[model samples]
Target chain A: MRGMPVFALGCALALLLAVSAFSDEPARAAGFAWETDYAVALQRAKDEGKPIFLEFR
Target chain B: MRITDLTVVDIGLFDFDADVTLYCFVLNADEQVYLRYGGRDDTSPDAYLNEKSLHAALEKGLDLHGKWKAGELKLPARPAAKKPADYPSVKSEVIDRKQCVHCHHTGSGKTKLAASKGTLDKLKDLWVYPDAANLGLELDADTGITVAKVKGVAKEAGFKAKDEIVKVTGNAVYTWGDLQQRLHEVPHDATSLKFTVRRKGAETELEVTLPEWWRATRIERRSFVHAAEPFPEFWGRELTEDERRKYGVKPGEFGAEVTKFWVKTNAQSAGVQVGDIIYEVDGTRSAPYTGHPALWVRLNRKTGDTIKVKVLRGDKNLEFSFKLRAKAW
Candidate 1:
């Protein structure tokens, strides 16, 4: 019974990490997590110091 | 790892032919463009599109980005920022209509605006994003930069099949799109281009001779920019092999039978009637082997220019003089 709270906290951390990993990107079954919004993607790119793979189709 | 599909936004400062159905740009947060990764020939919308090539481009883009972040690369100043709404044509055709500004609107808008201002040069302006085939180099459909065939000017330049193209005019190119953009920038009158290729294991430099009108390409069949060109005011079909034999049309010369007058065009004013076989325009007889002779006229002539058109009506050869005019887009 004493480990119950610690177990719940660990699950919460994992869930948090999962959410954050896909926070800016919409989840997809396969392929890339393509951000549909350019402004938001641009901001995220600036924050992450990463290059953007932008497609105009 | 960040991917963005620019469907829900305006492409301000992004310079590309929106007429292409698919296009990609790799850039850093500062909007420093590292490389481009999409292009097409007149044949197909995804002619040069390859998964492996795109992956290669993305990897190179990241490398360029890293070098840039580490101050190991120097990029040119970004081009002046411009938007679709900046052009009046987009306002009426897209923005004012409450339509999502399509990717192509940006290019059509700019060309239409230039047309309205009497600055659009049809001969030069209509040809956008010429293919690498113009250089007589056929790149591998899967790898993008590997030379699959070399003929014409490329063969003469000493380019060989299996040579991996590394750079164009000294600019490193990772994908077909990168090479195309660089080729499009070559001056219309340029006599030669410098190519760096990986032949076997050694990097070799070759000088590629530029054919006249190397920048000219077929107008995209789906683009509205064709509306800005001078209307031939006539429709025609290419002579078939039998018809060519009958008409004495040489294998490489242009020949077409005027099926109908599309509208009251200047050709009609000059007495060009249905059933007239058009064979030459303004003293030029050779064409790119496209069956339609009118294409040559549209590509070579400009609004307000007067030229002589030759045709054969029945057994008598005839000629007509007419002034080319622009159509209301």
Candidate 2:
């Protein structure tokens, strides 16, 4: 039972490191707060009563 | 903000000018487009787009949104939705697992399809993108959203410089994007255009007559022309009489001075250099008064046609043969 808590701690640390690696990438720094999924963005726009700024390139 | 490279079938609703490579749309969730942001004449992405213009378009879109919410502005009815896969080029590309058909290619693809259906017309300007300059309204170079000058028809119709165009053809317009949308909806044969402008805290209505060739687009910039006609991959301007004289060409003869060549195009591949004067195309002495050489090719030649061009490079006259290729974008 004591080893179980230690395993959980190890798993949490691994997850944290994995997330840190991802967060440090250049894409995260330079990327705008743009949603890539159109359906989700459209729903959010409707819910928030906002217009969609759609960039198609 | 929605950034996407995914092929959305609903692009038909926008009725884009086909050659648009980068396009930004400000619209409601219901697909009522408030305006658009990007347009290009040259192949370069930054040709008519800049950070300041995009920012101004966004600000104006938000302002228009406010009016829309307050019921003060009415937007046009949304078009029936059609999937992009329904487009022939897109469908073929998707089935072949090739790269998605670009937005600009849609116009030429449609033109080719029309040609296959025996309905090709040289005079028709397929996918005409509207420029406010047609109405004599010059937009600010930096912002591209504000009115910098109103001359000719717009000025004669009581429009003044600095008057922000608030509505066009009964639809609210906040930026050039919105203005373009409204203008696109205008019938090619429409005799007049109605617009409302905000000037000095008041909105005024004005109407202007449409020019005869108002529906005609700049052929050099149109991808549809490149797709369907035997066109050079370089851009050139019609030579003035003085330029013709300097080039040793007879007066009233047509010649186009090559100014720039798009990178990686057939012109560059064929060793067609800048500063070369195109004096003849396919044995025809290109008449200067007829129109631009590129436009002349678009009007006369069909796709797959081979064109023999004579260029005066310095004092030497050189000849080159170029084949028209289908739209590759």
Per TM-score, the best of the predicted structures is 1
**Candidate 2: stretches off by over 4 Å:** A1-31, B41-48, B66-73, B142-145, B215-217, B230-254, B257-276, B280-291, B302-329
What iRMS does model 2 reach? 14.9
Question: Per-residue alpha-carbon lDDT of model 1 for B157-218, expressed as tens digits?
Answer: 99999999888888887788888888877776678999999988999999988877676565
Best by DockQ: 2
Best candidate, lDDT: 1
* Candidate 1 lDDT for residue B29: 74
Which tens-of-lDDT digit does each residue in B106-133 have in candidate 2?
Answer: 6666766766677877665453666778
lDDT string, candidate 1, A1-57, tens digits = 111111111221211111112111234323234465566766877777777777665
Clashing pairs in 1: none
User: On a 0 to 1 TM-score scale, where does candidate 1 land against the true structure?
Assistant: 0.76
* Reference-based lDDT, each prediction: 0.71, 0.65
For every candidate, what share of the true interface contacts is present? Answer: 0.52, 0.64
